[model samples]
Target: MQTLETMRSLGLLTPEQYLEITAYVMVNSTPEQILAMPPHLWQAVMQADALLFPGGPAEPVH
Candidate 1:
């Protein structure tokens, strides 16, 4: 799973911008794809979704 800190460090994202982008990605991405992510990256993706859109509906899980 990628942390906000690590994503920032990796230049994949900045801590602040990652929240929305990660959520969008997670909603669209498959469970298998997400599961394949490193632990820190997975957590960051989940946390980003939860933070930006608490209780919000994700994209259809396909």
Candidate 2:
């Protein structure tokens, strides 16, 4: 999994852009891995996850 910092350093994206992508990924990705992400990415992931999983937030309930 590529981190936002890593993507930024690689010039693949800005921090904000990466955050947005991360959020998108969270919404589509399975719950186990999304839940495993580090704290820094949690908010972005959750936002995306919510958007993607509009029926409900992705789980392990966080």
Candidate 3:
């Protein structure tokens, strides 16, 4: 989950988004594979994270 930590630090994902995405990865992939995923692939996941979660992305914070 270090990549997730990095993603959070980078502001690509909020804490809630990180938790949701972490669960998705845990269910869909082996830990070893997740650790091996390239940075670019992680970026793709970040891009899609909000959409992948149930109920989708939040309505704007405004």
Whole-model lDDT per candidate: 0.61, 0.60, 0.68
- In the range 24-62, model 2's lDDT, one tens digit per residue, is 565758778666666656655455445544688436745
What is the total number of backbone clashes in candidate 1?
Answer: 7
What TM-score goes with each of the models?
0.39, 0.36, 0.44
- Top lDDT prediction, candidate number: 3
Index of the highest-TM-score prediction: 3
Candidate 3 residue-wise lDDT, 1-62, digit = tens: 77576766677777777776677677669878776656755665657565445476669977
RMSD of each: 9.2, 10.2, 11.9
Residue range 1-62, candidate 1, lDDT tens digits: 35554655665555655665466456758777657766665665666556555777678978
Choose 2 or 3, whichever is better by lDDT: 3
Residue 44 of model 1, lDDT score: 59
Cα lDDT of candidate 3 equals: 0.68
**How many angstroms is residue 27 displaced in model 2 relative to the true structure, after the best TM-score fit?**
1.1
